[model samples]
Target: MSVTTKTDGAGDSALVFEQRIQDLCHDELFEQGTGSEVAYDLISNELLLDGSARLNLATFVTTWMPPPAGALMAKTADKNM
Candidate 1:
């Protein structure tokens, strides 16, 4: 699969997944950049396996926040540290 990177209005980069591809292919051995690609694939798949964040409540804190709110919280957390 061809890897496509997306940029938001704010110029933040993100990955665009056309299909579910494992970051690491068990059949093939790892080579330099391939290993990292495999890892990214795995992480992306796991986070997106479920339909939506609201539907999944498996975490300790299932409270969902909008992206802006989450970003603000992340900044606040960083300041406290």
Candidate 2:
């Protein structure tokens, strides 16, 4: 998922906030780990202030998974043989 920010119209503050979120998502500790639940909880509790607003961070993490096309096919082939 790509997050686009309108830097010119929103001003520097918005740009910085967006950048921080992007950085957090791309952090090494988060990248090489399976902590979607943890990440989701953290974001929901800390960043999402509005009680009515709901965000699903798990969906974001799943976007980064390796495609199952060829991998699953190969596994099935092995099982059949």
Candidate 3:
């Protein structure tokens, strides 16, 4: 039986099921580009597998931040240190 993991998006090509096609290259750098949308989609889908962030009840202070700080973070997300 063929087992499939990915539910939607991506297209007919398989990432989890297919052993031949490499979803990502490990050692070697890509000689060609797959465009911004394709690269973003691949990363975004990978992050989805990690699930949403959850606050620990015992360390609520560490996880919960003021709305102002959160807004600031969101606004400055693109900035480099």
Candidate 4:
């Protein structure tokens, strides 16, 4: 599957999503794992479909948000689990 992105319109840069994924998959860190092209494509496609991980509010701990954002999220935080 081929993925393309516009450079001038959105915040995306010249490098398309597929190229970026290829670059990331080629990185030494990820290459050391047993993951293959099929896995990469599946994961990357899912991420693209899911939009930005930073925008996902369900998994708040891993996201990078503003300092005040913590206070807002504090009430819903899972302290027991």
Which residue pairs show collisions in model 2?
none
lDDT of 4 by residue, 1-81 (tens): 559632333322323444544434543464234334445555666668655546665666555778787777686555412
lDDT of 1 at 31: 56
The list of candidate 3 runs beyond 4 A from truth reads: 1-21, 53-81
Tens-place lDDT per residue, model 2, 1-81, is: 659633333233333335444435543454343244545555666644542212534324544446675577467754433
lDDT value, residue 64 of candidate 2: 44
The numbered model that scores best in TM-score is 3
**Candidate 3: lDDT of 57?**
35
**2 or 4: which has the higher lDDT?**
4
Cα RMSD, each candidate:
13.8, 17.9, 10.4, 14.1
Q: Candidate 4, 50: how far from true, in Å?
A: 2.5
Write down the lDDT of every candidate, Cα atoms only. Answer: 0.52, 0.46, 0.57, 0.51
Q: What is the per-residue lDDT of model 1 for residues 1-81, given as tens digits with 9 covering 90 to 100? A: 759744232311123245544444658665534334545555677758645635644333737879997787678753433
Model 1 score (lDDT): 0.52
- Give the Cα error of residue 65 in candidate 4, in Å: 15
Query: Best-fitting candidate, measured by lDDT?
Result: 3
lDDT of 4: 0.51
Clashes of each: 2, 0, 0, 0
Better of 1 and 4 by lDDT: 1
Sort order, lDDT high to low:
3, 1, 4, 2
